[model samples]
Target: MKVRELREHAKELDFTPQEQVRWLAPRQLARTAVKAVLAAVFAGYSDKREVQEVLDADLLEAPCGQPDAREIWIDYVADVGDGFDATSSVAWTLAEEELLVPRAIEGTDASPAVGDLRLRRGSLLVLGGDEVYPAASATAYEDRMKGPYRAALPKAADPPLMVALPGNHDWYDGLTAFLRMFTQQRPIGGWQTRQTRSYFCVRLPERWWLVGLDSQLGSYFDDPQLRYFEKHLSANLEPGDGVIVCSAEPTWLESVETNADAFNALHWFDRNMIRTRAVPGSKRRVPTHASVRLWLTGDHHHYARYAERLPGDPPGTGVPAPDSRRRQMVTSGMGGAYLAATHRLPAVLPLPPPGSRLREKDPPVAFARMGRTYPDAEESRRLARGIAVPWSGRWLPWRNLGFAKLAAGLHAGLFLLLCFLFALAEGVLRPVDAVRRAGLDDFWGFGAVCLGVAAALFVLGFLGRLLRRILRRLRRRRGAAPPSGPEVATARTALPPSGPAVATLSQALVALAALAITVAIPFPPSWDGWLVLLLCLALAAFLGAFVGSGVFALWVLSAKGGQVAEWQMSGQSIEDHKGFLRLRIAPGGDLTLYPLVLKTICRDWELRDEPSGGKRPVPTGKPAVRLIEDPVVISRGA
Candidate 1:
C-alpha cells in the first residue's frame, strides 16, 4: 500500500463522529493524563526487572562477518511503531511495506522507477532506535512493531539480517521487550540477526564498521556495554579503518547548559572510540588507525544532517577529500512516531572540538538545511497556485490573514465572557450597595479597571524587552574584547533576537478590548441579576479550566503539536511525509547518503517488471508469536 492508498484506508476505518472527536477533541487529553499517572506509579518496577534479567542471562556475542561484496548497501529507520491508533498503525504498515521490501527479486538489476533506488534483497536493515511507542510493553511491540513488520516483510527461507538498538522508550521497560525481539536467536518472519547483548558491532564491506551503542534510559552507557565495546575494540579494530558510530540520541544537538549529563557519555565515547584517545589522565588508548566518518542517531523524530569541518580548515573547502577531517552527524528519527518540527532549529550549532579539548563546545555551521518538511516539486507547485481563501471569498490581502483574525476574535470573545462572569460573581457575593459604589451601574469604573489591567501587563512586557536590550548592549560592550573562551562564545549564541514592541502593544490592546466588553452589558440591582452573574462566573471558570488542561496535555505530547495543527488548519500546511537515511558505502570507504522520503514503495518500482497475478504470501504464524512471560531472576550483583 502506498501513502495515498493508506490515506484512503485511514479514511475508510470505523472512525465515527465520536472516534474523530476523541482524537481531535479533549478525550485523548483525558486518556493521556490517566496514562501519565499510571506510568508514574508503575514505570520504575519494569526497570528493576529488566536490569536483573540482563545481568543474569548468559549473553550471546554474535558480531556479523564482513560481506563478500566490495560495495554494500544499508537501510536504516528509527523511532518506529505508531502508538495505539488503528489509523496510524495501518499508515505505518504501508510505510514499512514501501520502504523495507526490496524493489526487485534477489540477484537481479531491476529497472529503476522514477525516484526509486533499488536495495539488494540481503542488505542489512538497522532499526536505529525506539522500536515501539508509549512505553516498550510486550503488547505495544506485538501491535506496533512485530505484527506490522511481519506482515510487511514476511518469513523467507533466506531473508535480510536485522539488528536494533535501544532508545529511551525501549529502556522504559528495562529493555525486556527490546531484548526479546532483537537479542534472542529466534527469527521473526525469518529475518533475524542474532544479538546476545543490547549493543553490538557489525563489520561492513570495505574496512567499514558499524558500532551501535546503548545510551540506556539515563543517557548513560552501562558498565557492561562499555566493557563489550572495549573488548570489541581490542579484538577487531585495526589502524586507519573507517567507523560509523550509532547512538540513540544526538547529544551534540542538545543544549549543553541544561543537558550536560547526556553529553558526557557521548563525549567520552567519541574521544575513545572515534578519536582513538584516552580519557584525561587515564593513559588507556585503543590501537586503531580508524577515524569516525559518521555519527547517526534518531531520537529527535525528524531528519537533520550536520557536517563538521576541522576548526582550522580554510573556508570554501568544496572538494571531497578522502582523508578530509570531516565528520557527518545525521538524525533520521522519522520512523513512525509523531513527527517533530525542525523548522525552528538554528542554522548553526555548537559541537565539541576534536582531540584533548573535547569538553569545549564550538559553533559550526551545518552544510545541509535542517527541517521536517523539505520542499518538493509538487509542494512548490501547490504553494505557487496560491492558498485557497476561507468562506469562498476572493482577493484576501494574505492567505492566513483570515485565520489570524478569527483566532484573535475568539480570544477576545473568551476574555470578555470571563470578565463579565467575574463581575457577576462579585455582584452575587457582596451587597448591591457595596458593589454599586464601585460603578457597576456606570461603564467608566469597569472600563478603568480593565484598562488598568491591560496597562500593567503592557508595561511588564515593555520592561522585559528593555531588560533584554540592556543585557545585549552590555554583552556587546564586553564582546569588544576578543572572545577568550568557549563560555563567551556560548553566551553570545544563546541570546535570542529581540522581539518587536508592536507585538506587545497588540497583546495589550486585545486584553483591553476583551475587558471593555463587560462594561457594555448593563447590571441590574435585583437578586435575579446577582444569581445570573454568579452562575455565569462559575460556568466560565469550570469550562476554561477543563479546556485549558486538554490543550496543555496535547502540547505536552509534542511541544509543537499546536503549531503543526494550526498550520494544517489554515491550509498552509506542509505535506506529512516522514523520511529516513539510505547510506551507500563505496569500495573506497566513501559514503553517500540519499535522504529517502517514505510515501510510496512502488514510486521506484519498474513498470516493465511488475509482478503478475499471484497474491502476496502471508506468513501463517500467530501474530503474537514471540510473547514471553518469563520471570526475571534477580542476582546479588544486579
Candidate 2:
C-alpha cells in the first residue's frame, strides 16, 4: 500500500462508533445508491448493442511483425481504476511501476526495488475489463486511466501493443469514451493500438488466436458481433488452432437465483463461436475451430482458476487433454477494486462436463490450497462471535446478542414514542367510554397494558434472530448446507417471494386482521369500538414499517461486504488478495501463467509449479529489440 492510502485507511479506522453509525454509514450508503441509480438510468437510455461499424470491422493489426523467436509477453489486468479510492489508486500505480515497466539497464549497479518484475518491449498489454470506475465519462477516463498510465508508463522508444474490452462500467455512457480511447487509431506512449470495434481477434505466432467478446450490460452478444465471430472462424480459423477467449464478465458465476439461467451467455459463446465445427460432406460453411484452449474473464473482483481433472491423468498436469483442452476457466478480476469475500461459496458450481475426447489433468495445487481472506473477514468473524456490532462503517450483518439487544432497544424506543403520541390525541378527543368506564381511575392500568404490549413486541423481534440461528445450527448438524450468512436471518424474517400485487394484498389482509381482532375484544358496538379498531390498524402499520425498515437495513449492511456475482463461478480461490495473470506464450504454443499480486509492496508475484503438464522452457537472455511500423492486415473471403 502507498503511504497516502495507508494514511487514509488509518483515518477511516479512527472513526468513533457513534460517528460511523450517525454519519459515515449513511453518507456511504447514499453515495453508493445514487451512483447505482444514475448508472442504471443511463444504461437504459443507451444503445443496447455494439456499434455497426465495430461489428463489421476487421481484426486490429499490430505495428510490429511476429517475433523471430516466436515468443510473446502479455500483461493482463482487469477492473483497473485510475484512482477511485486511495488504496486502489496506489495499488494501480504500484502495478504499473513494478510489473508494467521493463527492467532497468543491466550492470548499472541500481538496487532492485521491492516487487519489481518488469515487462519487455514489444509485449502485448490486454486490459481484461473495467478500465475506469464511478462512471465511464470522458473526464473520468482521462483522470483515472490516461493520466495514470502516462505518468507510470512513459512513452517508450519501442512500446508494446495495447488492446482492451469494454466492461459493464464502461458501457454506462454507451461506450462513447471507450470507443474514442481504444477504437480510434492512437498511440499511448510508444505503444500503438488500432481497434475499430469493442471486440477483436488477434492472430499470434504458432497458429494461436486471441478472441475477445463484448458481453455488454445485458450479458448477451449483439447480432453483428456474433456474425463477425462466425465469419472469422469460418475463414481464418483452423480446427487445431490454439485459442484463448476473453469475456467482459464471468457470467458463468451468476447464481441461478440472480441470473435464472446459469452460464447462459458463456454457453452460447462456447457453442456458437469456440465449439462449432465444419459440417462434413456438406456445402454449407461453418466455423472450423472445434474448441478454445482457455477462457479468461473478470468482473468478480478476485482471482481463481478451475481446470477439469481427467481420470487417470497425472496429479499436476496443467495441460488439458486435447479433447477437453478448452475446459479451463480462469477468473482474474482482482485488478483493482474493493476485495470480495471468498467464503460460503457453493460447493458444486454448475458447468458443462468435459467432452469425451478431451483429457483432464489434476487441478493446480495453488487452487487446491488457496485460503479465504478479505478486507472484512476479521470483522465478519468478530460479528459472528458477538464481539462487535454493526457500527464500524463495514455493514456486515449483526449475528450475535449485541445486535439483538440493539434492535430490541430501537423497537422499544419507537413503540414508546408512538404510544405517547396516541395518548396525547386520546386526551384531546375525550372519548365518552374513557369517562363512563371507571373514568381516569383506570388510566394507570391502561398505560401499563400498552407498555407491556410494546415490551412483548420488542422481545418477539429479538426471538426471530435467535430462531434463525437455531435453524442454521440444526442444518449444519444434519450435514445440510445452510444459506449464506447474510441471507440466513433476513430470509427467515422476510415475506415469501411474491409479486407486487400479491404483496400489497397480503399487507391489506394483515391490517384487516388486526382491526378484526381489536373489534372482537368485548367492546360495545359504538363509535368507541370503531375508533379502537382504527387505532389498532394504524399501530399495526407503524410497527410493520418499523420492523420492515430495520430488516432492510440489516440486509443492506450484509450486502456491503459479502461475495460478488463472480463468486459463484470461483471453483476455488487461490488466495484472498487482488491480482492479475501474466501469460507467456511460447513459440510451440505452450503457455505459462504467473499470478501477480497488485496490492503488495514486496514480493508481489507468485509462480506456481503445479499443473506441470504443457510447461514451457522460460526464456533466458534478452533479444534484439526494434520498432517497425507494419501495415494493417485485413483478411477477406476470396
Q: Which candidate is the best by lDDT?
A: 1
lDDT score of model 2?
0.48
**Top-TM-score candidate index:** 1
What TM-score do all the candidates reach, one by one? Answer: 0.61, 0.57
lDDT of 1: 0.49
Query: How do the residues 1-638 of candidate 1 rate in per-residue lDDT, one tens digit apiece?
Result: 33333323322221110111122223333554555555455655544333532543332222234336677666677877753222233223332423333333222356423443443433567788888765677767765667546535555544556778888778766677888878766765546766667777777766677888876554456566666666565346566677778888877655332243445677677656655644435786654556677778888665666555444545542422222355667787766664444544434444442221344553333332222233232343333223233232211213233333334444545654535444564574433223333444454565566567767876787788789878888898876533234322232243222223333334444443434333344456565746744543443333333332223222222222233222222232222345556666766656665555543211211111113322221222211101011111111110
Model 1 segments more than 4 A misplaced: 1-70, 83-116, 255-262, 277-286, 310-313, 316-325, 353-357, 360-444, 454-575, 586-588, 599-638
Weakest 10 consecutive residues, lDDT, candidate 1? 623-632
Q: Rate the local accuracy (lDDT) of all candidates.
A: 0.49, 0.48
lDDT for 2 (candidate 2) = 30
Candidate 1 steric clashes: 3
User: On residues 46-99, what C-alpha lDDT tens digit does candidate 2 reach at each position?
Assistant: 654545544347764333464444767666778766232322333333334233
